[model samples]
Target: MIFEKFGKKRESAPPHQATPTDDSVSISRRNFLKKTGLFISGAVVGEHESEKFLKKIFKVPSAEVSPKEAVKIMPHKEKHVSAHSPEALSEPSPEVSTETSKESSPLDAYSFLDGQIHPVAIPTGELAGNTFSDLYAMYLGMPNGTVVPETLHVDFKENLATLWRKKFNLPARSHDERVEREQLQFLEEHHNLMNLAEYVYRSYDAKSPNTMTLEEYRNDVVGAVEKSRKVFVDTLPLVPTSASEDGVFSKDKISLISKMGESLTADTLMSLSFTELMPLDKGSANAQVFGFLLRNAGVDFIDRIPSVYDMLESFGPYQITPDALSPKSAGSWATQVLSALPLGFMPWNVDELLRGKENIAAYTLAMLNIAQFIGTRNSAQLKCLSEVMHTLPSTQRAKAVLSFVAAAHHRPHEAYDAFDAFIWSMYVERAHSFREEDILRHIPTKDLREYTGKALANYRFLASGASVNNST
Candidate 1:
């Protein structure tokens, strides 16, 4: 019964082909057979074993195999039959098989299995997902008609005060307090010159309006003269002479010089009839007398002179007694006094009153004046004007200079020329003496020009009724 069953199974199996020698078989084929579970114990069946099995089962001879055949077939062996039933291999359900087929088709399996496969998933719709552009726009987009806020401008003087505090080693106080303290110190030190100090203090005071019309300034001068006449008594002789060859003047002579000096304290020097101090002919006896008096007055007396001169200069416009004092003589005198004074006299100048101080009103007026000069292209005015700018801290200096440049560009020749030849000449003197490079060093020329252009455009836009926030 065993032989009959084996014979029947051998008849049902396919015919075996001749096998190639082990050496002639390729590594790929050997690997394929091993992977497919066709080999027993991971090794190829021996030709002898195959032949023996075939002969025993179907009575076939090994010599009958053709040399051209390469495939070798083995007869199936009956599995061990146990007394108990065997468990069947588990199979997927129909639905599970269908899902697995869809998930891993021949193409997918080939892609996964093949080394040279290039696969790409095809996009199915226009709006596949949020793209980078869409996401970027969503994050960055602003609503239509959104309004930007106007840029607030800081006062240049405040900027100057802040910068001054930062750059210089000063007392630990607010800028305003420091300024006031200095002004008070200046006043206290020169108590005799209270009137001139008061005038300067008022000019730089934040509470006072910084500007004055020519008429107003002249009227103040006249009032100052009357006030001085009331408060100061001129007791000394008009002319005093040296009593000795050493050039030491008598006490009465010194007293007279001191009284004449009082003219400065009273703010009456500007009001003095030019006849009283003029025609300063280099060779004249009167000029010689005046020169001697000034020389003998001592350094302390000369030190007080610059502040008085600065007060007179601050008036901006005034008339001189042409017969008594030529513009040339006035200029010469101013030059002489300026040269005689030390550099400390600089703070006494009207423009420098608020140095290391907080005086926005005065700073604004200065800006206005600088802007006017820029439009005029009056290098002389700009020259003198730049002095105040030079005194500012670096940041404030740049800002003030740029503001001047911008204002000039914005309103070129907008106003008629108000300064006369003498005034222009005087400014030319001061301007030529000023070191422009000192201030220009703070800002690049190109940046200044660009800033001017932008400022002009802004001014034009504002003039046209466009909002500054939207102008750019």
Candidate 2:
């Protein structure tokens, strides 16, 4: 799902500083929000269970929370946020236009971007899809094309590679070449989509406000659905047999979920959360969503949750501003966490990952990116790792948490930027809700820098397959 890079950085003004998307709005304040935090969730998504992530995180009767709340934030009128905001990240548009506009602009092309993954739309034949194109047709609840139930059976990896070849006009090849070239092409697209995701969040989600019009809403529906399938689907491994930790979701229910996953992106897989897919009541909507995500992202995706969370905590565009963060800050530490992924000790630069890597290097690089962190960490991210563990219930703790302190990247102060204004801090004075004891445990009351250093060194050596004697 890697898209070609746009020439200019599509900078959006933050709400306070926002200019009008149309003539109706005015803005007095804004910032560029240029932060270099890591991306938490690496793989593509937007499935029937999209809302389930939040539900699982905060178990309760489901509120009317939008499925992809992270993508479209309604306006919050605090000192930091303004009443007049862009639906871009969000402040709802001042007015609603139910009827289609008399004319349209280039932005109209992104109409498919409604970005929720509810209805199932499977592409057939030698067709196409992209983030800015038809990728989100199903999510917009305006699925197009002749979708047969059989499309559910296509091989996820092979189909993606097929789409890559057809898009580029690369000739069909023998088995050996298909194994080599198509695999390489798929990896390249994988890296490319990561870059584009960064760009999309940095430019649009970070700064510009978005509007929801009757016509524009229609397109956002389609465009967002397309974007998810094209972007995250590239990173998923093949789906495993869908089952809960205790195996609650039945085969028939799992099949329906598989169908939903496949329709969204021509595969069966599911992803997100720690411990428990949800209650097993076969008729429950929550149960169905859990089953759907399980089928769409595959079982191993369960372990990858923290790694993806690490990326969101560290690299998410809204989190860090290079200048505001000093060298000693946790933001720098989060950057190191990216270098220390358990996938291997390759220092991954997003630019290098997105370059002319149309060979094995692309696939290998993605392996490191896609591989789970296994709760690994250097001194830099140890507290953040512990926080992630704390975010989970003790009952939900599994071997995944036991593998903690291995390798991951993220900083606490910078990580909370999305919750507050970008004015986040290590002390977190504004976040009164976090328990004092919980925060105190991770914070080093007495210096244990030596143990911290050794822990990081040992883990890196172990993760990289270096011998104990190689440890510093």
Candidate 3:
């Protein structure tokens, strides 16, 4: 049964095609290894290529161009040195004893003379060596060089890519960045409710005093319940099974609901413990708190426990007369009885037991008997209370019903009122109307409180008719 709860299957797969046992195992093992190996190797190759590609595009090596290449590629004009001169002198430096023929005709007419030619500015010799150096200083404190640092080091690949992207003036849409963005969106949408619920619980439960006051804690619980209720209500708009389209809750709503219930239960238990620690008479303030809580919450049992106590004493001595009972045994018996109870009455019983320090088993048995009898009389209350139980948070809802079995036996008068009130509340709140017939269906005329005067006046009309019918 427990395994079924976890969705585990005990059945093994049908036998594979019959083969030599060792061969079959070996084949399966080989297939698994082959797939794993391919996956890992592909990942490694992809990473290696990615790194190399990033490095190449960033042009880190481009900055270190060879000096020879720099000079070859230097933007400058070739020398037309000495070209503007007498034709003969420029022609060949005319080793003709000077200018013998002086190109006699033209020379004599032009008096040929040596001249120098300079067309704009150009480097003649080894300026190439200093070309890049000078350019580096000019741009990088040198002409045509960049004012970039000599080196940069990145420890993580993400950092490396970020820097490269910035250097290249690339837009923010790289594969890695896009993938990260998508992942963030997916996680945000997937875990919003879960994360919120967790935060609320932790925020309320934190050990640090700075987080919340008692009022704040109470408010937080209320807020969480309200939110959960709203989500559940919103789910109605969705196709019964289509939570996705409805946007009613994330897939984690179940987990959130569970966590919320757990937090609320723990906090409530803590509050109860605090009540226990109060000095006897000092409990009034705690009672007031409980009262306030009951008023705010829609449950009816919270209003009727004291009434139950009063009624139980109405019949006979209902005091806790401790008899032959070990505390452990009593506790064990109570636990068993409480465990078996239906969910609607469990919380009331738990509250009763924890409210006093009497022999729990004896008191619990007495309480259960009273509740059963009263439940028979006030069937309307029983039905109303049952409806309330159905609406409570899961863990508490069932346990609350179980608590009643113990209450019914201990304090019949009070239990009757408390139980009936609970049932009435449940019916009104859940069903929107309470039919008298429904009440009579569960409560037998033999037990109707109407015969006892104002105590059960709520059903006097039925009680009178029932009495007349019996006489006839």
Clashes of each: 0, 53, 50
lDDT against true structure, model 1: 0.24
Error of 2 at 134 (Å): 5.5
Candidate 3 global CA lDDT score:
0.26
Tens digit per residue, CA lDDT, model 2, 1-472: 1111112122341211001111112111111111322222222222212333323222322265443332221122232331112222222212222222333211111111112122234343212222111312221122345332323333222222222232223333323534435433432333232222322222221112232222232233245334433332332222221111122223433332222222321000111011112111121222222233224422212111111111121121111112211112233323333323334322232222212111122222222222222112233343443343344443222212111211111122211222122112322343323332232234231222222222223222222322212211
TM-score per candidate? 0.16, 0.22, 0.18
In order, the Cα lDDT scores of the candidates are 0.24, 0.24, 0.26
RMSD of each: 48.3, 24.6, 38.2
Instruction: Output the TM-score of candidate 2.
Output: 0.22
Name the top lDDT candidate.
3
* lDDT leaderboard ranking: 3, 1, 2
Using TM-score, rank the candidates from best to worst. Answer: 2, 3, 1
What are the runs in model 3 whose C-alpha is more than 4 Å off?
A: 1-319, 322-363, 370-383, 394-411, 431-472
Candidate 3: worst-modelled 10 consecutive residues by lDDT:
1-10
**What TM-score does candidate 3 get on C-alpha atoms?**
0.18
